[model samples]
Target: MMARTKGTANKASSQNENVVTLENPIKRGDTLIETITLIKPNAGTLRGVSLQDVATSDVNALIKVLPRMTYPSLTEHEVVNLELPDMIALAGQVIGFLSPTSVC
Candidate 1:
């Protein structure tokens, strides 16, 4: 195996801001970081998971919606499961999290 050159590491690090920084970062009051998961296009459509629905919920309710946004497809009684990728994108903004910011 080869070690990464110092120059290469610096260049890569500069390009990717998502990489954790070692220095002090700007802090905002009560700001929460959320991870937006990759959406599975193969999954079928499931409504009522949009950003509008999520934003209206109270903090506790929002907590419940958070897990479901990125959850994998599941089967119930042999029905094909659906993943909500679109909802992930929309809800990301509603919750003040950074979206993958890519259109699919």
Candidate 2:
């Protein structure tokens, strides 16, 4: 698998946030089905909730809401890689994105 770095500027910081893209392992014929972005959760986002709380929350809700938030074009089957831990991490990342100041 190959990796490449992409950067985007966030209003909070003049420094570009580095986004790493990893080549998908699974494939359907010669075409790549889709690409997903992975964001590192900002620890400060978890105001009251512990990591365990985040992990134990209803993943089904995350599964439903995440596609709407990020990849609306991709179908359910396309998100097969997103398991419980992935969902929790995504939730944290999203919480950070929506309210950069604080999750509370």
Question: Whose TM-score is greatest here?
Answer: 2
For model 2, how does the per-residue alpha-carbon lDDT over 11-104 read when each residue is reduced to its tens digit?
2233532221223422444544333343434444344445454455445444544444442233445445654444444455554554436466
User: Which residue runs does candidate 1 get wrong by more than 4 Å?
Assistant: 1-35, 38-53, 71-104
Model 1 lDDT tens row, 34-86:
22232322112323344454446333334434444432211231111113342
Global lDDT of each model?
A: 0.31, 0.42
Runs off by more than 4 Å, candidate 2 = 1-29, 33-57, 80-85, 98-104
Candidate 2 structure, TM-score to reference = 0.39
User: Per-residue error at 4 for model 2, in Å?
Assistant: 12
> In model 2, how large is the Cα lDDT of residue 6?
27
TM-scores, all candidates, are: 0.23, 0.39
Query: What's model 2's lDDT at 19?
Result: 24
Candidate 2 lDDT at 66 equals 45
